[model samples]
Target: MKSDDVAKKLRRLQGQIAGIIKMYDEDRSCLEIIQQVAAARSALSSVGRDILTGEACKCASVKPGEDFDKILKSLLELT
Candidate 1:
């Protein structure tokens, strides 16, 4: 949840994306390419989950309500 941790995770995901690009350039097998795609997807999902959890915690700390749906809706509409 820290900036350093988030940066590290983003770097790892970037590396995975680069590897997928390299594999494509080298004409890697379909299975290998798919595997790399899956890995990248999993990494991105992990990062998203981390962000969501951290935000949820922060929101909960300031807002002492059990209306998660309302909170989430307001958060989503912010942008």
Candidate 2:
């Protein structure tokens, strides 16, 4: 996905996080809070995967001799 798409996902996640906080403040049920927290975590994981996929694609397009070891290391660190 493109950066704009990632940004949009991040914004949505931000809203979800805020909502979770609101739920907590309002004394929502444990199950309800847990569900929202799980959803947010899934969304964040998706975003991270998207970013890594994009970076991998970019790296693949580079010339064979290019030094991608550092980039690969950084990407691995993210996981």
Candidate 3:
């Protein structure tokens, strides 16, 4: 994803976090709060996955026979 897209996602994640905090403060149903938390986590995971994939794709164009360690490191770091 582009940096702008990533920034937007992070901003949205911030909003979700703020909402979760507000719900907790208001003593909202635990299930509702948990659901929101899960949504936020999923969004974060998506952003992370996209960033890692983007990086991998960039390094993937290395010339044939070039060192493969960089690509391996990128995938390894993802885990």
Candidate 4:
């Protein structure tokens, strides 16, 4: 994904995080806080998936040759 896309997604996530924090300060119900936590986790997971996919795509464009094994190992390590 492009930097702009990543930035936009992160900005939205940041807002969500801020909202969660605000809720905590206000002593919101445990269920409400937990709901926010789940949403934040889901958002972060999506961003991570996008990042991994982008990295894989970039790596695929390279001529691997002898380094193919090393690249594969590194990619595996990432997961």
Candidate 5:
């Protein structure tokens, strides 16, 4: 995905975190809190996957002699 899409996802995750904190402060039900946390985690994982996919696509487009090993290493470390 594009940088703008990633930024939007990050902002949404940030809002989710804030909501989680508020729920905690309000002593919301454990189930509700857990559900929100799971949603946030899923969102973060999606973002990570998107980033890795984008990086991989970029690496694939490079010429044969280009240094993609670094990108490969970074993607592996991220996973």
Candidate 6:
């Protein structure tokens, strides 16, 4: 996906983060905050996966994969 598309998806994630902060300020339940934290982590992982997938596709199509090492590093970091 394009940077624009990623930014659009992240807008919702931004809201999620803000909500989590608000919940903390409100003295929300520990369990509830933990659940929100997990959800936010999952969302961030999903975004990283999407970006990696796009990069991998590009690397595959180009053949020889001059940037394969970079892409592989990103995948390892995400995992």
Best by lDDT: 2
lDDT of 5 by residue, 13-63 (tens): 999999999999999999999999999998998898788877687769775
- Which pairs clash in the backbone of model 2? none
What is the per-residue lDDT of model 6 for residues 1-79, given as tens digits with 9 covering 90 to 100? 8878888879989999999999999999999999999999998888877787777777675554658667666675864
TM-scores of all candidate predictions against the true structure: 0.75, 0.76, 0.75, 0.75, 0.76, 0.72
lDDT of 1: 0.80
Which is the winner by lDDT between candidate 2 and candidate 4? Answer: 2
- Supply candidate 6's per-residue lDDT for 4: 86
lDDT of 2 by residue, 22-74 (tens): 99999999999999999999899889978886778676867534467566656
- CA RMSD of each candidate after superposition: 3.9, 4.0, 3.7, 4.0, 4.1, 3.8
Give the alpha-carbon lDDT of every model.
0.80, 0.86, 0.82, 0.82, 0.86, 0.83
Tell me the lDDT of candidate 5: 0.86
lDDT tens per residue, model 1, 31-76: 9999989989978877876777567767674554558657765654
**Residue-pair clashes, model 1:** 0
* Cα lDDT of model 3 by residue, 1-79, tens digit: 6889888999999999999999999999999999999999989888887777667667776753446666656565764
Where in model 1 is the C-alpha error above 4 Å?
62-79
Candidate 4, residues 10-29, lDDT tens digits: the string is 99999999999999999999
Instruction: Quote the lDDT for 12 in model 4.
Output: 95
lDDT comparing candidate 3 with the true structure: 0.82
In candidate 3 the C-alpha lDDT for residue 47 amounts to 84
Error of 1 at 65 (Å): 9.5
